[model samples]
Target: MRVLVIGGTGFIGQHLVACLVRAGHAVHVPTRRYQKGRNLLVFPTLTLFEADVHDDAVLERLLSETDAVVNLVGVLHSKPGRPYGIEFERAHVELPRRIAAACRKIGVRRLLHVSALGADAQGPSGYQRSKAAGEEAVRAEFSTYSEGALTIFRPSVVFGREDNFMNLFARLARWLPVIPLAGAGARLQPVYVRDVAAAMANALENSQTYGKTYTVAGVSQYTLAELARLAAKWSGRPRPVLPVPHFVGYAQALLFEFLPGRPLMSRDNLDSLKVDNVSDEAMAPELGVVPTPLESVAPSYLRGGKPDRGPVH
Candidate 1:
C-alpha cells in the first residue's frame, strides 16, 4: 500500500510513519518547511513531500500519487497567529472535508484518521468540537466510497519517549519545586505511542475495519492529580502538587493563552478535562483491541528509568 501521511513530522506522526513502513507500506511524509536537515530523519521506505497541507492544490496533487491517506494533524494549544479554527478546525474538520473531496476527485478511497478520545461534535471546547466535526465529515462523505472504507481511531493522551504530555510535565517537574494543577479530578487513560501507531497500521491494512470508529486507551485510568504524582515519581522530581481551583486555573489560562510561549494549561484544555478522557464501555467490544497499560510503557521513557529506555540516560 502507498500511504500518504499528513503531519508526519510530528511526534505521533513520526511513530506512525515508521510503523507503516515496517508493515511493508511505501510511506510519504509531507512537510511545509524545507530545512537543510531535520532533527529526526524519515526511514528508507519513507519519502518526503514538502508542501503546506492546508493548501488544497498541494494536498490534491499529493493525493494523486497515493492509494490511502492517514491524517495525524492536530494541535492542543493555540497562539495569536494560529487560532483553534486554523489549528484544529482547518487541520481536523476542513482538511477532512478537502481530503474527502479530493479522494472523491482522485478516486482514492481508503483513509484512516486519528481523533482524540473525548471528541464530541456538539461539544463546547474548540478542540473536541473540531475533532468531532472532522469525524462527522469523513463519515458523511467517505463512508460509502468504494463500499464503506474509512477507519477512525479515537485515542486518549498518548505517552512515549517523545510524547509532549509526559515530557513537558517531566521537564517542569525537574526544575520546579511545585507544579500547578487544573481540574485535578479529571481522568485520563494514557495510551502508548507505539500502540496508537499499531492501531493505525492495523486499520490501514485490514479492510474489515473500514467505516468503524474505535476508541483506544491505556489499560488503566488515572486522575489528573494521580498523573502528576506519577510524573513526579517517574521524572525523579517528587515535587509538591499545587492544586489550583477551577476559577483560578481559568484565570491563569486566560493570561497564558496570550503569552508568547505555549500555555502550561489553557481554559479550553480545562473544559476538555471536564469530560473523561477514557474509552466508553460501548466501544470496548466493538473495536476489540486491548490497550497496553501505561505502567508497561512509562518506564521505557520515564526519567531515571531503566538504562537506554527513558527520557534520561
Candidate 2:
C-alpha cells in the first residue's frame, strides 16, 4: 500500500510513517522543505516530497499516486476570529475537506483523520469547533464519494517523548520555581503517542474500522495539577503546583498571547479546558492496541530518558 501522509514530517506523523514502513507499506510524505524531512529518509520504504499540500493541483497530484491518506496537519495556536481563526479554518477544516475531496476525485479509498478527543461543534474553543467541522466536512465528502472508507480517531491529550503535553510540564518544572497551574482541576486522559500511531497504522485497511469514529484514551485519568506534579517529581524538581483562580489564569493566558513565539497557553486553550478531556470509550481493544499507562512511559522521558535511538543514515 502506498500511503500519502499530508503532515507526515510532524512528531506523530513521523512515528506513523515509520510504523507503516516497518509493516511493509510504502509511505509518501509531503513537506514544504526537503531538508526539514531529510531525517525521514532513514526509513527505507518512506519517500519525501517537497510540496505545498494546500494547493489543489499539488493535492490532486499526490492523490493520484496514493492508495490511502492520513491527515495530521494541525495548528494549536491561532489568532482569534469568529467561528474559528483563519489559521484553524485553513489547517483543520479546509485541509481535511480538501483531502477528502481529492481522495474522492482520485478514487482513493482509505482516510484516517486524527482529531482531538473533546472536539465539539458547540464547544468553547475554536480548536474544538474547527476540528468538529473538519470531521463533518470529511464525512460529507466521503458520503458523496462511492468507493472508500473514513475512520476518525478522536484521542485525548497524547503524551510521549516528543509530545507537547507532558513535555510542557517537564520543561516548566525544569525552569520555573513555582508552577502556577491554570485549569488545575480540569480532567484529562492522556494516551501514549506510540499507541495512537499504532492504532492509525493498524486501521489503514482494517474493515472493522471503516466509517467508525473511535475515541482513543489512556488507561487512567488525571487532573491537570496532578499531572503537573507528577511531571515535576519525575523530572526531579518536585515544585509546588499552585492552583490559581480562573481570572488569574485568563490574565496569564492573555499576557502569553503577546509573547514572541506561540503563546504558552491561549485563552482558547483555557476555553478547551472548560470541558473534561476524558472518554469512557475503549479503542485499544477495537483497534487491537494495548493502551500504555502514563506511569510506565512518562518517567523515563521526563527524566533525561534512557538514551534515544539515533537516526539511521
Candidate 3:
C-alpha cells in the first residue's frame, strides 16, 4: 500500500509514518519545508513531499499518486470565530473536506481522519465544535461510498515521551514550586501516542473499522489534578497542585492568551476541559489496539528528559 499522510511530520504523524513503513507500505509525507520532514528519510519506504497541502492543485497532485490518505491535520489554537477559530475551521473543518472530496475524485477508496474524542457540535470549545464539523464534512463528502471507505478515529488526550500534555505538566513541576491549575477536576483518559498511531495505521485496512467513529482512549482515567501530581512525582519534582475555581482558571487563560506564541492554556482549552474526555468504548476490540497506561511510559521520559514544548494538542 502507498499511503499519503497529511501533516505527516508532526508527533502522531511521525509515529504513523514509521508504523506504515514497518508494515511494508510506502508513505508520502508532505511538509511546507523539506528539512522539517528530513528525519523521516531513515524509513526506507517513506518519501518526503515538500509542498503546500492547502493548495488545491498540489493536494490533488499528491493524492493522485497514493492508494489511500490519512488526514491528521489539526490546530490547537486559532483566531476566534463564530463556530470555531479561523485556524480550526481551516485545519479541522476545511482540510478534511478537501481531502475527502479529492480522494473520491482521485479514485482513492480509503481515508482515515483523526478527530478529538470530546468533539461535539454543542461542545464548550471551538476546537471541539470545529472537530465535530470536520467529521461531518468528511462523512458528507464520502456519503456515497460504502461503510469502510471513510473511517474516523476520535482519540482522547494523547500522551507519550514527546507529548505536550504530560510533558507540559512535568516541565511545570520541574521549574515551578507549585502548579496552579484550572479545570482541576476535568476527567481524561489519555491514549498513548504509539497506540493512537497504531490504531490509525491498522484501521487503514481493517474492514470492521470502515465508516465507523471510534473513541480511542487509555486503560485508566485520571483527573487533571491527579495527573498533575503524578507527573510531578514521576518527574522527581514533588509539588502541590493548587486547584482554583473555573473562573480563576478562565481568567488566567485569558491572561495567557496575551502572552504570545501558543498560550500556556487558552480560554478554549479550559472550555474543552469542561467536558470529560473519558470513553467507555475500547479500541482493542474495535481496532485491535491494546491501550498503554500512563504509568508505564510516562516515568521514563519525565524523570530525566528535557521538557520540550510540542505542538500536538
Candidate 4:
C-alpha cells in the first residue's frame, strides 16, 4: 500500500512509519524541513516530501498517489478557548477535516486517525474537546466516502525510548532531589510506541477496523505518581514525589505556561488528567494485538537501551 503519513517526523509518527515500512508499504512523509525527518531517511521504502500539510493543494497532490492516509497530528498545549484554543482547532479539528475532504476528493479510502484516550466532546479540557471534534469531523466526512473506511485510535499516554512521557520524568528526577508533580493520582495505561505502530499497521490491512474506534492501552494501569517513581527508578535516580493539590497544580501549570518554548504542563493538560486514561482489555485484541505492558518495555528503554522485542502478556 502507498501510505501518506502526516506528522511522520514526530515521536509516534517515526515509529509508525518504521512499522509501515517494515510491512512493505511505500510510505511518504511530509515535513516542513527535510533535516527534521533525516532520521527516517534510512528506510528505503519511505520517502519524505518537503511541504506544508495544511495547504490544500499540497495535501491534494499527495493524496493523488496515496492509497491510505494516517493522521497523527496532535497538540498537547494550546492557548485557550471555549471548546478549544486556536492551535488545537487548527491541528486537531481543522486538519482532520481537510484531510478527510482531500482524501475523498482524491478517492483515497482508508484513514487511520490517532486521537487521545480521554477525548470527549464535553470533556473538561480544551485539548480533549478539540480531539473529540476532530473525530467527529473525520467520521462525518468519511461516512459519505463509500469506497473507503476511517479507523480512529484513542491511545493512552504512549511511552518508548524516544517518548517525552517517561523520559521527561527521568530527566527531571536526574536533576531534582524531590519531584513536585501535578495530577499525581491520575490513572494512565502507558502503551508502548511500537505497539501503537503495530496496531496502526494491522488496522491498515484489517477491514474490520474501519469505521471502528479502538482505545489503545497497555496491560497495566498506574497513577501519575507511580509512573514518575518508576521513571526515576529506571533512570537510577530515585526521588521522592510530592503530589501537589489541584489548586497548587493549576498554579504550577499556569507558571509553566509562561515559560519559554512549549510549557511542561498547561491548565488544559491538568484538566485532562481529571479523567482516567485506560482502555478495556478487548480494545487492542480487537485489532489482533496484545497491548504491551509498561513494565516490560519501560525498564529497557528508560535505562538507555532499546528492547529486543515487544512486550509479552
**The best candidate in terms of TM-score:** 2
lDDT of 4 by residue, 1-313 (tens): 9999999999889888888888899999999999999988888989997999899998999999889999999989999998899999999999999999999999998999988898899999999999999999998998889987899999888888778899999999988999998889999989878788888888898977878998888888899999999999998889999999989999988999998999988999999999888776555555767777788878877887767332211
lDDT of 1 by residue, 1-313 (tens): 8999887778778777777777788988888874621533546677875788778898889999999998888888643222345677667888888888788778888888888898886665778888888888987887556643788888889888767787777787888889888888888888877777777777786766877888878888889888887877887777778888889999999988888787877788887888778764433443435676676666556775553232110
Total clashes in model 4, counting residue pairs 3 or more apart in sequence or in different chains = 0
Give the Å error, residue 172, model 3. Answer: 0.8
Give lDDT: candidate 3, residue 6.
Answer: 95
lDDT of 4 at 187: 92
Residue-level lDDT of model 2, residues 1-313, one tens digit each, is 9999988888788888888998899999999999988989989888898999999999999999989999999889898987899999999999999999999988998999988898899999999999999999999999987787999989888887877887798889888999998889999999987888889998888898999999999999999999999999998889899999888999999999999988999989998988999998776565879898999988888898853232211
Clashes of each: 0, 0, 1, 0
Candidate 1: misplaced stretches above 4 Å?
Answer: 36-42, 79-86, 143-148, 280-290, 304-313
By lDDT, the better pick of 1 and 2 is: 2
Which window of 10 residues has the lowest lDDT sum in candidate 4? Answer: 304-313
Q: Show where candidate 4 strays beyond 4 Å.
A: 308-313
Residue 169 accuracy (lDDT) in model 2: 88
Tens digits of per-residue lDDT, candidate 3, 61-140, equal 99899999999998898777879988999999999999998887888899999999998999999999999999999999
- How much does candidate 1 score in TM-score? 0.90
Give per-model CA RMSD: 3.3, 1.7, 2.9, 2.2
TM-score of each: 0.90, 0.97, 0.95, 0.96
Sorted on TM-score, highest at the top, how do the candidates line up? 2, 4, 3, 1
Model 1 scores a C-alpha lDDT of 0.77
Whole-model lDDT values for every prediction: 0.77, 0.89, 0.87, 0.88
- Model 3, position 286, has a per-residue lDDT of 58
